[model samples]
Target: MMLPSKTVLVFSLFLLLNGILPSTTVAAARTTIGFTYSAVPSNSPSPEHVVAALQSLNIPAVRLLNPSPTLIRAFSYSNISLLLTVPNHLVTSFADNRSSATLWLYNNVLPFHPRARISLISVGADVITAAGDSGSDPTTAIVTAMQNLHHALIDLGIRTVSVSTTFSFINVITTAFPPSSAEFQEPVNSLVIKPVLEFLEETNSSLLMNVYPYNVYKLHGEIPISFALFEEGPFNFRDDVVTGVRYHNLFDMMVDSVIAAMAVSGYENVPLILTETGWPSNDEHMNVEESKMYAERYLQGLISHLKSGLGTPLRKEGAAETYIYQLFDDENESNSRRNNSLISDGDTMQQHWGVMYNNLTMKYNIHFDNADQISTVLGLLVPSMYFLWLLYDFRLAGILLVLVYFHSRKSEGLDTKITFITCQIFTSRFISGLLIDIDDYFCAFGAAKTHVSRSAFLVSTMLIFSVA
Candidate 1:
């Protein structure tokens, strides 16, 4: 007995759909890449222009260092998630008074929340760096502020936005070379990070850290420039002697270092978000490493690696969210002596870490939403191809459908079912073609060559049975 052709077609279609749908959806749940926007006085683009630019580039999220009411309102109905930051200057005030946090939210969040899609509230940006200026315990201020903000949100009956603070890797992590041996820097780890980690774990929030491969490369001259720029090669890798894990890029090595530090702190499950990571296109000194070419390469490579769905060596799932350091170049900051160290090639250099210009034009050609675009095109294309085929002949239509199905499955690493279904399609086509030619052969040969038709029929029967 043989299976019906309709049943075979249905079964093949079922398997084909099951195989292709999951691969297409993998990009949806992968790490989200966004941009960090800090408005510079008298130099920043308008909120409408900024929002329009982000939407034009298909960027899905943004971290606003200066979340003014007007700027926050611009993101309304944009479908771009906003990560709002409370300046370091306000941390102490927010911590000392819960009403301050509530008042801040009412001004910044209450009006445009669900419309703007506000996602996370970072209490402070690198609070440790500003500890000396504030004359207060940085750790205490961060944790208390976060608690006040969390409570404030609850009081407002809003639960969607999470609270956390950001830290710079170079300022906090003690070691990063052999990522497995990495740990948070001493007093801050004990005094500040531990309690912060505990709060994050209890609330199910993420720890935000600024991971800069360029800084790490500058600090350690032994690291090759290619490794920092995300260029893949056999020599670009660094092995963690303790964990026996091979890191192909500096970004992953730095991220895994944070993961190792978190694990040592007994809060391994808390999610990690990279609040800042980017290469500068140019600097005041015009350093060789800070060229637009290198910047473009770094941005493109980083996006590709994250979208590839290959997480860090330690944590299979990479940073839950990552924001490129900035959206527009700050001409003023390029001249400032911020974080210019003796190790930075013996010169005070601050790179312009913006992907775009103040004029709202892109500085680097990087595709932020390529995966989504490809998925969209294929979603429409597959159906359109079938519709066109339906207007043609069914035999040719079946062949085209099978070819498309095979190609899609092949991209996902084809398995036995795909190969079998492909063979079934061709075999069914072969049998149909043979049956159509049998009448011509019978008329030309007459009753004397009836065995010729019989043999062909038997062969077609065997092929159909084999497919079944």
Candidate 2:
């Protein structure tokens, strides 16, 4: 592996140039992204403030593992879509008695529905393998609870509120190499996952999966850091030996591995909604810079990929939504029941996944929405240095070009109009275009159906100049 600092520097430069470039395709935007608000509310942000901040961020969706009265009140009458989760313990509660699902809705959904944008009710958060689950047959319990809830929602004419569950990627997926070769291991797949897939298929709801490339990369150092951070990883590009499908990043690999598992289970077509993914701002060692960059690149590259409509190799142009794992650091320990990480309890990293300090200070220096990401204080320094180097080289080249132009004008008496046009074509059109114009990147990467999209980016920027 390359030195991490050098790799990070190169990655930042890549983002800077990528952003500065003009694109023929509609520029990538924040299309399928949301926040998984911390399960138990944090000490700060008063539930009200959390909702208010979303409004200012121009974000219209948030997922809550457990509902809060204050959150309901704040979300009520607003345009924000809420994905409320049913706790694991309650899975058996509703399973023990199906009719109780109706009561569950009355208490949770009825109070905040069309008015508060309560769009989805995730059955439970990672109940299948959650450490403390008491249910012997989690699959049966979770399915029964979902069926009951679905019936109750349909009876109440709330067809929009879909039902599903959130699952983590650790200890569940046995192998995820080459994506097409991926599959789930025994018991977990047969006992729980298969039935859940059938239920979600019947209900036409997307599966909620938690994928943390940070954890995968941290634990398995074999994976490149760039791949973990969502940067274009040359080392990660691989073609599946079995199915011949290519995968680029660990994020897509993890997601498609579940899709592969589904195919192995005799179920092949179920969409996924990423319910949790975020990097901590610090760990026991307080590595804030590395932590913040991890958050920055991972989120930025994901936003671009989704906005590009380039789904995983399995579904090239499909849809997927990713909710950042957490909104605030759980300083009060509201949702630390499962630390999933191998770190000791003393390591604050498990709880410090917020993109900022609870006080709203930019911990990752992150920007939400369509704004250019990766302009963070740390990210900007590398590009600023690279720009100076480029300026020096560019000045040297400009002097030579000027010397030739003036020599020609004085000695050869070149036609003034011809000289000016020649200069404009070279300096204004081709060179500038070379610096920041990408046409049909999909074809550039050499994917299938290249001819179909090859020329769509042909509208040379001459059109922009003429119109302006």
Best candidate according to lDDT: 1
| Candidate 1 residue-wise lDDT at 119 | 90
lDDT of the candidates, in the order given? 0.77, 0.65
**lDDT (10s digit) by residue, model 1, range 141-260:** 889999999999999999999999988888888889798888999999998999999999998899999888887888788899899888977689988878888888999999999999
Model 1, TM vs. native: 0.72
| Total backbone collisions for each predicted model | 0, 0
Most accurate candidate by TM-score: 1
Residues 76-151, candidate 2: write the lDDT tens digits: 8668888888877788888777678888888778876778888788988878666344536675688788888888
Model 2: residue 130 alpha-carbon error in angstroms: 2.2
Candidate 2 clash pair list: none
**What's the lDDT for residue 172 in model 2?**
67
Error of 1 at 278 (Å): 0.4
Model 1 misses residue 274 by how many Å? 0.3
TM-score each candidate: 0.72, 0.68
